[model samples]
Target: MSESITVAGVSVDTRHWIGGRRVASAGTFTDHSPIDGSAVGEIARGGPDEAEAAVGAARDAFPGWAATPRAERARILHAVADGVEKRTEELAIVETTDNGALLRSHRRGVMPRVAHNFRFFADWLLRLDHEDFETRGHTNHVSWDPAGPCVLITPWNAPLMLATWKVAPALAAGNTVVLKPAEWSPLTASLLADIAAEAGLPAGVLNVVQGYGSEIGDALTSHPDVRRISFTGSVPTARRIAASAAANLTPLSLELGGKSPLLVFADADLDLAVDLAVEQYDNAGQVCLAATRLLVEEPVVEEFTRRFTEKASALRQGDPRDEGTDIGPTIHPRQLEKIDGFVQRALAAGARAVIGGHRKDGQYYAPTLLTDVAQDSEIVQEEVFGPVLTLQTFTGEDEAVRLADDTRFGLAATVATGDRERAERVTARLVAGTVWVNCFFVRDLQAPFGGSRQSGVGREGGTWSFDFYCDLKNTVTAPEGWDQDHG
Candidate 1:
């Protein structure tokens, strides 16, 4: 059910899928399941040479692939969606084993979204439009052209879903891709790449290279031949990748970090608000858009805190694969320790822990909730990337907007209020790219998804992804005798 692969016949160790083949290589790294801290398998450790080969394969495939009719490309995407559907169970198992995501979440949430992205982009390909402009005497046309050989760098948090957001559109727009999966969760990436090959994608159109970011990611980001780069990761890494991409002036799209806020008004559906807030922090707060900060109106702060803390305390934390577990371990031991330190520092700075805080082991930390944290504290200001929520109270709507916009990251914000006017006003003022009213984490494939400010640049999902993967060109022309006619 689980295996590695080698693309382009470059044999390597671990379970690496490369160029439509399963590869075993000498250099490998052990992959552990965060659920129980057990070894799942080893992943091939690709180096510069392998990365170059993968990129080269993409380059070689770009001309023919991009020349294919758009309808044909859409057919391929439809087939990909079908393959993913057929393997939903297998993919879900690998996803949970690799990243500690809940099996139900993968089956019910991630997979459906991934399939939707493919289907949505497939429709976009069929209806792609070009604009015609009539100058005084000549006709000008604007066309979107595929950027050749895209380098897709996906994160470990939601590997398959995030990769599909990029891969679906890039392929739909006729660009070949070389994907570098996060070193922490390479299994699903490898598996998905193999599935794409099996879905009848021509050799070299999609390639997966496995290794650490410093080695494989850096090589892919800086490679001169890679025409575009789409990356999803931390803000610092986004900056570095942007700098490297500057060498050739290659186009880049980034989906970086966030410290999103969830504002609860006095009139909000309190029960619903509390439930959504707790669910947002379910994945140990490893999600980029997790509502880690709760800004409640002063009048209802006490009641909201009571309900929120009670729900937070009731959350079950343990092995990710267990049916009863509501929260799982952090992706890595280092992340666990880092989150623990952040909570400790908040406590030292006069914050009150209303619920879980301490770590059970090196990998698992309780779903933590802290109140009375200073606005400037690291726990509130920086992205903890853990399941830690800090509560703050504001006096009025204006103050709520100000406090929510205070952060450097503007990825997402949620407002819980039944008043339509107030919701609209608060939503408009929030600096985040995505604003949710009375709901949280609900995304449609047809909607543009990305962040503002330090959260990220450019966008993904919907038609926006197709625009990001392609370049626009304008052509002005006349009839065969138009030059003389114009003169």
Candidate 2:
């Protein structure tokens, strides 16, 4: 039961999950394992033609699916949750193998988070209110309507979890979706489609098109029939999508890249701070919220680095599927090269490599830390998206906030200080959308998640996502004695 499932009974080619069936297309793309650089699977590389088909499918199903009651949609989503629960182990295995994340994290952390997203949005559907009111001597009411067919583009890092964030809410809001998963990690997306189909979702409500970004992604974003576009990936890509959506003025929500930071004050708990530093770099620091820059107060810089390096050095890095592995290889060989270049550039600019500064095999890069990195260096200026963290020290709260805010990205940040007043003050000054006080990556289902500046344009998660996927329509009713003709 854990074997690879094929589309159209063909092997060695790309496949698409459309209308509850695994259908193969003429175009194909190769998918590789980041750890060993071996071919794991192939996905049907869709192009303009396939994009049209997928969009058409979603459009065809839109009216009926959007007309379905919220309660019925909730039942379908709950069934998806149940189906995911049934194949939890298999999904986890495929996810780890395909995405190069630790198996334990996928099974315990990400999987549960996906389930929680579904359940949370399911409940949100029941609680949504289209309330009536009186305003200016006139009866008024508000209604929320689905934006019809949505084009959802998910990234590779947390494919299923991120997809769930979009899919759950969009479905709950009564929208049909055409999901274009990142080509690098299509296994879990395919598997997720299977699970949803098994859960008895109506045909054409959800479709997965696997392909390169240029082909399928471009077509989907610019498609005339798509009412909205929801994307989670790089800022550059998000910008491109925005421009494309502008062609038709289609509504869009983007959760793009991040160059997040962590600030540790002199009075903070050094051990806890060190733990968080390591945790931020978990999964090779590929996360959008990873604290790539550690700004420590001058007095505690030495001790913090000592503890942080000790913890970073102890992280077990090897096969992602291994139960004992804490970190895994970068998701692609090109990603490793890019990270290496950043480290090399930082080193050339007079930064010191505190722990790891090299690469191994095809895509395996050790958990790395850098010290004395110049504020203007590429490592600090751009998002590394690897297992690398740069260290810098600040003399005071003002300087710390200045250094943290001195970036194009304002995604997430962490401040560790025992002084409540100081923490509040620093949090206010930090430009990031999500600021963690003395903690990192601890997210709640109900919390609004997104970033400021170049990090992203709109928010995901919370009730806000429902608002993002749907449009607001206000209605006004005349009083019983009101006469339109006389007026």
Candidate 3:
């Protein structure tokens, strides 16, 4: 039986969704909201056994689902999208409470994107192309085939959104999925399974196991039956999961940590540059693609810094449920400590805190900006994964591109320049999966999205997504009218 769990006054069934039903684990964990550390839900604490059950269920359902028509699969996904849209308000509130993001942002943007992920992939599946080439009197045909049970290990920052990013593609390809959402924010994931079932998704088609990565990551990834593993999280964790998947030779698509840069040039609109800089603090700076490092041209550094400081300082930080609040508390107490530690160490090493550099209130770290940071310093070199930005001055396009590409992580980057030619020139030199010239987070479903190096292993979006979730096959046919019986 499932138990009702309440977060931000939104109640959801918080039990593990396994084999099309809610199931409990041998133990339970109290999920707390970052707002005030109040217990929001008692959730299932899964272990190796739960992982095994979920994997087995998915394997059992794979053949039947794979044989189903793509149109039918699209239909079910759309229905799930409908369910997601209908419950957007409830889902957004729960996600805000569970993940510690602004309720307004989730309600207006994040949850809507969640529904769009499913709808886009659903219709895109119908447009999947097949190739038929005639060569040397023989016909060669190429098509995509669904891989078996996929293990989707999603991160906590954008729990439901990122999970659906992989889930939609995998399910659309007719592969069953076993999703393991991060333990930190799992309430919404449970609610997702409920929506899928209500939308008439077949039993065993979608399953979720709730547990710490240490307990279930290996068990899920190393399973011989698991064909694919898509993970989005830390570099260290990706290493561990990669090791486990290696034993089974399972294919992995890893979207790891990022330390992206936002380059501001002299020709850039100073007002727009400052606004985009402040926008990095969205989601309390937990965004992986946020331009944490601000590389500015020496000509306009002072004015840009002043405008950014004013806008950021005015940002309302409070309860996520409030419409006026721009940001909420960090997802956990330890996370707050980790964020402060990064700032404190950088300050000790001579980095100047422009406006904020410390805690504001309970679990709330202020929107922070640092100047006077060295290029090779730890603060600029690593992924802090907090609402902290570092500024460093450069002279020209070459230096700016050099600074942007300095980090090992390159998930995304932004170049704010008024010159069209300069935008193209610098963006090409900067090594990132996605780069925006004047805008920040302009996403298109058809574009390839991933990192150049340690940021991620494979791309996700459109055909790139299908490429990973499916296996491309070529079948060669004999010449027309050539029959063995006649011979």
- In terms of lDDT, the best-performing candidate is 3
lDDT (CA) per prediction: 0.84, 0.85, 0.91
Sort the predicted structures by TM-score, highest score first: 3, 2, 1
TM-score of 1: 0.94
Clashes of each: 17, 3, 0
* Candidate 1 residue 46 C-alpha distance from true site, Å: 0.9
Task: List ranges where model 1 is wrong by over 4 Å.
Answer: 1-15, 22-25, 479-487
Quote the positional error of residue 37 for candidate 1 in Å. Answer: 1.2
The residue ranges of model 2 lying beyond 4 angstroms of the native Cα positions read 1-14, 481-487
Which ten contiguous residues of candidate 1 have the minimum total lDDT?
A: 4-13
Query: lDDT of model 1 at residue 15?
Result: 55
lDDT by residue (tens digit), candidate 2, 1-487 = 1125442132222467776566777756777877677777556778988889889989999899889988888888999998887777777777777788888988888888887777889899889876688887687777779989999999999989999989999988889999988888887788788778878888999999988888788899999999989898998888889989998999888777788889999999999999988897687888998888989999989889988888888888888888888888899877888999999888888889999988876688978889988788788999989988999999998899899999999999999999999999999999987999988888886788888998887787767888888887888987777566994
- Which model is ahead, 1 or 2, in terms of TM-score? 2
TM, every model = 0.94, 0.95, 0.98
Q: Model 2 TM-score?
A: 0.95
